[model samples]
Target: MSTALVLIMTPGLAFFYGGMVNKKNVISTMLQSIVCMVIITVLWGIFGFSLAFGESFHGFIGNPATYFMMKGMLGNATWKAAPTIPLLLFAMYQLKFAIITPALITGAFAERIRFNSYIIFLVLFSIFIFSPLAHCTWHPDGILAKLGVLDFAGGTVVHMSAGWAALASALYLKRRNEANHSPARITYVMIGTGLLWFGWFGFNAGSAFGANALAVTALATSTTASAAGGITWIFFDMLRGRKPSAMGTCIGAVVGLVAITPAAGFVTVPHSLAIGIISAVVSNLVVEWRTRTTIDDTLDVFPCHGVGGMVGMLLTGVFANQHVNAGNTTGNGLFFGETHLFLVQLLAMVGVSVFAFFGSLLLLKITDMISPLRVSAEDEELGLDISQHGEKL
Candidate 1:
């Protein structure tokens, strides 16, 4: 059920992003996200999962041989992370995580990238970038895990990495050519938002690995944070002299979900509320600020996910209560009378931001080499649905 719920998020994301782009590009934009379910799934089964969850290789990556072709995962085999479920089930669950991370990057370069080049990037990023980061942060013996970075559910690994990669992609791809641009369909965006919100409960709570109290708390915090975030973003819209909009409210709710992910298991309901509202306000400001800049982060993925992940990580260090989850090997946060965790979270965010940004930039270059990264100007004007796929509504 958890895996099924999370799988829905990628398609949800496709619609969310599809509706935000020009009508001519809608099909291509949605396909970019849906395609990850295909490419990343194959990659994960062969080696991506092993590189992330197999035997640790010096705290940076997994040994491909440890679970080659997912051997030893049948029958009574079990993983330490979730001893209650079969190892195979756990692998599928994590595969959903792997699938969505790259899909998120599509939003940054939706209309302009060559479809073939993006497919190549999907493979490369899963193997080289997302796998290693997942290893470092989630593996029990991984370096950052040993340093006590508290990512209950991939705040750093998923959202932060994707956010940084989105920024790198925007910088590399440059601006789109559209002179008069507006979303093609806000109704699609609203429906997509609802699907994303419904799936997120599983995304956060399912990270608990069992039907336990931690899962319950994660589910609770996720809901509270999203509500607070939506309200806060609308308030910001009003303060900025614009009417509160459905689109803005939807984006705010998703931002809250992103911000609460890393800390959901460690913080209380109230802390989640604070984290949501604070992140919404900040992301709203960043989106507004982006309009004056040259960096065309088409969907504002960096400001929302990247910044939200950073905020959640830092606040987790601030509001973490060992009483919520006694499993925290690291001491409590600054609010809990320990400054070490806060500093550690900051350092982890810096390291991840640098690695993801530079790594994605490099991958984009390599992908460009493999197949021209951007479409020709003629193709761009024709729209990707027509030019790339030979189809259009």
Candidate 2:
């Protein structure tokens, strides 16, 4: 059920993103997300899962040969961390994550990218960026894990990396021909937000790997953080003399979800509330700041996902408690007067930000060379839905 929940988020993402694009480009934008479900699944079964969760190689990545072609996944096989479940179940659950990370970046390049080129970049990102990060952060023998960096879910592996890659994509792709357009469908955004919020319980709680107290704690934290985030966003807007909007509410809730992801299983509900509030404000400010710049991140992916992930990771180091989960061997957060965990989390954030940002820029360059990354001016004027897919809203 958890696996199914996570899988639904990709389609939810499609709707979320599709609703935000120009009406003429809505189909193309949504398809960019939907395609990942097919592409990443095939890759994961073949070797993508191995590269992320197989035997660690010098703490960098998993050896692709270790779980090649799902060779060793028998009925009794189990991942070390998730002993109660079959290895196949864990693999499938993780696969949902791989599908969405690339899909998330679609928002940045929405309506402007060539579908074939985007697919190329997605494959490259899944292998080079997403897989290594997942290995380093999650695998017991991987570098960040060994360094005692704690990511209950995928704050780093999913949000941070996707966020950075989104920035790189926006920069490389440059501005869309018509960058200013009203949303295609506000109702779709609301529906997508509902699905994402509902599915997120499984995304966070299921990380406990079993039906346990930790899972319950994670579920509660996720709920409060998201609620706090949604309300805070609208409140902030009203304070600035802007009307509270459904769009603001939806974006705020999602930001809260992203912010609480890392700390959900490691922090108290109150701290989760703090994380949600802090992240929503920070992301809201960043989104405003982004509009002042020449950077054309169409949907503010960097502001919401990237900055939200960073804030969550840092706060995890600030508020994490061993009493919350005996799994935090790195010691308590800075709020408890322990400096080691916070410093370690800080270092990991810097390293990951640099790696994800620069690595993605290189992949975009390569992908562009293989196939033109952007559509021609004629095609752009026609809208992606009609030009790219020969369809329209």
Q: 1-393 in candidate 2: lDDT tens per residue?
A: 889989999989999999998999999999999999999999999999999999999999999999999999986999998888999999999999999999999999887899999999999999999999999999998899999998999999999999999999999999987889899999999999998998898899989988999999999999999999999999999999999999999999999999999999999999999999999999999999999999999999999999999999999999999999998999999999999999999998999999999999999999999999999999999998988899987
Among residues 3 or more apart in sequence or in different chains, the pairs in candidate 2 whose N, CA or C atoms overlap within 3 Å are none
Measured with C-alpha atoms, the lDDT of residue 332 in candidate 1 is 87
Candidate 1 residue-wise lDDT, 188-268, digit = tens: 899899999999988999999889999999999999999999999999999979999999999999999999999999999
Model 2: lDDT of residue 281: 98
Global lDDT scores for all candidate models: 0.91, 0.94
> Using alpha carbons, what is the TM-score of model 2?
0.99
Question: Deviation in angstroms for 376 in model 1?
Answer: 1.0
- Ten residues in sequence with the least summed lDDT for candidate 2: 384-393
Candidate 2: where are CA atoms >4 Å away? none
lDDT of residue 166 for candidate 2: 95
